[model samples]
Target: MIPAAPLASGRTADVYALDGDRVLRRYRSGGDVRAEAEVMRHLYAEGYPVPRVHHADGPDLVLERVTGPTLVEALVGGDVGVRSAARLLVDLHARLHALPTVRATDPAIRILHLDLHPENVVLAPAGPVVIDWANAREGPSALDRAMTALILAEVAVDRSLPLSAAAHELLMAYVAEAGPLESVAAAARLRADLGAPDAARLPDAVRLVLAAGAPGDRAGAGNLALPDP
Candidate 1:
């Protein structure tokens, strides 16, 4: 049964409490959720901190109701530190990248959460559980890491957003521990295609990402612009 109101909402979907233990996440524009559900199920089987899926049909996915503040919420409330958040993100990426792909011909291909930013992570009682698999795909781990870095970099440079300064510090710390960001340009291109509202900030985002990376690897990236999608 559908609830009277959504428990939460996001760019592409809204989550409604179905019961005490479960929630239904429905996309605004209806579409099949089998692929997304399959990925989440695979991740859960691999012991990742994704919500347990009970069912998926059309645009609706029923999943375990995870309770806690999001990573962004925790950080904004001073419940977590920038360095700590950076480390946690790195750890989550490492764990996710370690898992094998659900189905891929290439061995290097692993499950990639194209959107792994703080707002998409729930700091549950058990641990941090990642949500929103809409952008999930099988790809090189570097691309996934690059996506996250680019997302943070966007916020770091956007003065309109709250916690912009902390975002910069978080970006610096995250990039330091994030290893070679060789796929940042690719990530930027993919992000550009998503039609994000802050598309104008992408040029600045690319520059910030380059600056945050180690000296030599930043070449050919400092002046990068969002390729037309």
Candidate 2:
């Protein structure tokens, strides 16, 4: 049975409690969830920290009920430090990029968690579990790193945000440890494509990315937007 109200809701989905420690993640606009489920299953099989999938059909996905504060909450509550958060994000990016893509045929391709940020990371008892595979795709690893940096920089450059100072510190730390980043422009375009309110701030975000020593955008880098399966 489904709950009358969702336990939590996001930009595209609502999560409702179900029996036996499971959740129903229902997308508001109703789209097939097989691709997302398949990706999560693949990652879980590879020993990556992702919530286990129980069932997936149409727009509804039944998933393991991972309980814990989000990484953002932990950061705000002093459970984790900015440097630790940066390292954690960097580590997650490295581990995820090391995994093989589920559907892409290219040997060079890897699974990109385009939306891997603090809000999507759950500090569960077992470990940090990455959630929301709605934007997963097979692509260059740099895009993933760039997307993360762009997301952080977007908030970092906006003084009006409560966490702006903290975000700036984290962004600097992340770029310092994340090695190389070469797709900021592509990442910004993808972010803008979402038509989020912050889309207007992408120019500032990109400037911050460059200021942090990332290559920004190179000659041949292309924006990525794989269609949902």
Model 1 CA deviation exceeding 4 Å by range? 214-229
Q: After superposition, how far is residue 136 of candidate 1 from its true place, in Å?
A: 0.5
Model 2 misplaced regions, further than 4 Å: 216-229
Per-prediction TM-score to the true structure, in the order listed: 0.94, 0.91
Please tell me which predicted candidate would have the highest TM-score against the true structure: 1
Worst 10 residues of 1 by lDDT: 214-223
lDDT of 1 by residue, 74-125 (tens): 9999999888999999999999999888888787998999999899899999
How much RMSD separates candidate 2 from the native structure?
A: 3.9
List the global CA lDDT of all models: 0.87, 0.87
lDDT of 2 by residue, 1-229 (tens): 7889999999999999997689999999999999999999999999999989999999999999999999999999999998899999999998998887888888778999899989999999989999999989888888899999889988998899999988899899899888768878777777777554556677777778877877646442334342221
Model 1 lDDT on a 0 to 1 scale: 0.87
Question: What is the Cα-based lDDT of residue 11 in candidate 1?
Answer: 86
TM-score, candidate number 1: 0.94
